[model samples]
Target: MGLGDFADKAKDAVNSDKGEEVSDNAFDKGSDKLNDATGGKFEDQIDKGKDAADDHVGNE
Candidate 1:
């Protein structure tokens, strides 16, 4: 819904260490925010966003 919400979700997800499970949800939710913030310019990069979020959470 927002950055704060996303962060909260991510925190829990990352802490759980279930990288693959949370990856799609985090990517879809966060990527929507990113796309909205960037005025649709980031629509072409959902995969990158997903991968980045996956890597970040996976590392935790």
Candidate 2:
């Protein structure tokens, strides 16, 4: 991947404890925005998506 992506991945790894919430909140916000925009069509996948997103962030 690109340097920016690598930098972000490293940052997230180093900041994982605090970053967990940060990542989760970001994922949740994105999910909420998408769900709201789509009128709940994606509601079922929101939680799983958020969890997967957050896991990826924390996985390093």
Candidate 3:
């Protein structure tokens, strides 16, 4: 498959229930790591980013 085809398949997978669960878990873990690394100084921004990512991935 070409790049566009691969992207479409990935998007489809991410829009599924199981994929959303995995995506949320990954985002939570990543956000926690970033918060820890930054001593929670950028927690708000991190959360905003996570929200935006979730919206992009059609989590809700």
Best by lDDT: 3
In the range 1-60, model 1's lDDT, one tens digit per residue, is 999999988777666747556665767788888888889876878758677766766435
Report the Cα lDDT for candidate 3.
0.90
Candidate rank order under lDDT: 3, 2, 1
lDDT, candidate 2, 1-60, per-residue tens? 999999978786746777766676778789899899999987888868777767667535
Index of the highest-TM-score prediction: 3
What is the C-alpha local distance difference test score of each model?
0.73, 0.77, 0.90
Candidate 3 worst ten-residue window by lDDT: 51-60
Clashes of 1: 0
In candidate 3, how many Å is residue 33 off?
Answer: 0.1
Q: Per-residue error at 20 for model 1, in Å?
A: 2.6
- Show model 1 residue runs off by greater than 4 Å: 1-19, 51-60
Q: What is the C-alpha RMSD of each candidate to the true structure, in Å?
A: 8.3, 4.2, 1.7
